[model samples]
Target: MVNCVVKNWQGEQSGETTLEMPVAKEENAEHIVHRALVRQLHNQRQGTASTKTRAEVRGGGRKPWRQKGTGRARAGSIRSPLWRGGGVIFGPKPKDYNLKMNRKERRLALRTAFISRVEDLIVVENFLDQLTAPKTKEVVNALTRWGIEPEQKVLLIVTDTTPDNLYLSVRNLPNVKLLRHDCLNIYDILYADKIVATSEAITKIQEVYCGE
Candidate 1:
């Protein structure tokens, strides 16, 4: 359980909120979180890299020099590994990089990672109504008021009910990444220097992750 200060759009402390989630034990917290991170990063790989071997290359049927002394070493095919424009030797082939972890372990890892970043989490009131239109400047100014520097990376957590205006307003800000509460991941949680989450989004996170 942690206490977080809730701020309004004006960056004033309106109230406070409590965050309680089931995190892993300290003994293996790092290990589980590391596993989850590696799994996620590895699973994102396309693994579509492929290279043709000598036998798979085209135009390799006829022997290059008939295996006889023609003032040069005999060559079996033009597509040999040693020849120019030839097939690759021991090259990479398409493969699957997906890694698996139990659902419970994955959740535990996520909870642990999220909790570890408690110091950087900033809870703010729902300000969807504050933005009447898609204005990037408004979001930027709000971020500045929220104590976030312009250059700092921020992970803005919103709820599914959040309007597209907020999305449009924040999309142009390269330093800010907007994510939904339920779609939260360890990568984004740990990647951002500061996490700006709406009060409603925080509640959704607690409900989904804490199972409350």
Candidate 2:
């Protein structure tokens, strides 16, 4: 369990909240989190890279020269790895890079990683109505009030019901990543310099992750 301060749109402390997600044990926290991160990154690879071997190359059926050459080395075929424009000796081929982890372990890793960033987590009250139009400047000003710098990377977590105007307002910021509560991932959680989650999103996170 962890306690967090909830700030309003103006960045004033309006209330407080708590997160009670189950995290991994301290002894195995790093290892489990690393495994989860690696699995996610590896699974995203397309694995389309391929190379031809000597046996698979075209025109390799006919030998290039006799076993005992006059002056040059004895060559088996023109597609030999040693020859120019020849097949590759050892090269990459298409393969699945996906890694598997149990659902319980994955959840544990996520909870642990999220909790570890408590100091950088900023919980704010839902201000969906604050944005009347899709203006990037308004979002920047709000972020500045929330103690986030212009150059810092921000991960803004919102509920599914959040208005499109708010999303439009935040989409133009290069350093800010807007994600729904249910779409949270290890990469975004760990990569952001600051995490700003709305109060309702925090509740949704607990309800989604803390329950069986």
Candidate 3:
């Protein structure tokens, strides 16, 4: 059991919580995390880049000049790759850049990443209810109380039970990201310097990831 400090909105230690989720037992767990990051970044590519090839270019129907009578080099097509307005040669085409990741591997990678970052996790009990309104100043004040600097990247993990005000409050804040436990991914976990989670959010994660 990994015991962690649970803090309130004021950054005071409210209690101690244990991480039921499995921790990485391997010393080389970071290698799996790196693979997961690479897979995530690769999967994000749109792969929609396209270019017209010489064969697909139009206006090449008639020969520009006789095959062997032109003073200059004989041109068979106006849209030759050598011409100014010619089609691109060996240009890019739309392709799927999506990388495949095994489901078990992804889960293990996430577990490893969370274990690696467990020290940075701050459990804010009743975080959403702390501030009733969607005020940026209030959010900033809460984070400030938690000793979080303004420019620090934070990932707030919430759950379906969390209020809309919490989402609206932190969306525009600098370097702060909000995600439901269901939507939690390895990218956000690795990108954030600190992760603040509501007790409810922790419960949700435990249900999905701590099942063993």
The best-first sequence of candidates by TM-score reads 1, 3, 2
Report the Cα lDDT for residue 163, model 3.
Answer: 69
Shift in Å, residue 45, candidate 3: 1.1
TM-score of each: 0.97, 0.92, 0.93
Question: Worst lDDT window (10 residues) for model 3?
Answer: 159-168
Enumerate residue pairs that collide in model 3: none
- Model 2 stretches astray by more than 4 angstroms: 65-70
The segments of candidate 3 whose C-alpha lies over 4 angstroms from its true place after superposition are: none
Candidate with better lDDT, 1 vs 2: 1
lDDT of 3 by residue, 24-143 (tens): 558768787888899999999999999898888878889877877567887888898899888999899999988887887788889888877888888878776676888888988888
Q: Evaluated with lDDT, which candidate comes out highest? A: 1
lDDT of 1 by residue, 1-212 (tens): 89999999999999999999989989999999999999999999999999999888889898767666688987888898999989999899999999999988888999999999989999999999999999999999999999999989999998863568988898889999999999988899889999999888888888888762
Candidate 2 local Cα displacement, residue 14, angstroms = 1.5
- Which candidate leads in TM-score? 1
Q: What is the Cα-based TM-score of model 2?
A: 0.92
Comparing candidate 2 with candidate 3, which one achieves the higher TM-score?
3
Q: Candidate 1's error at 115, in angstroms?
A: 0.8
lDDT of 2 by residue, 42-121 (tens): 99999999999988888877877788747888887889889887899889999999999998888888888999998999
lDDT of 3: 0.82
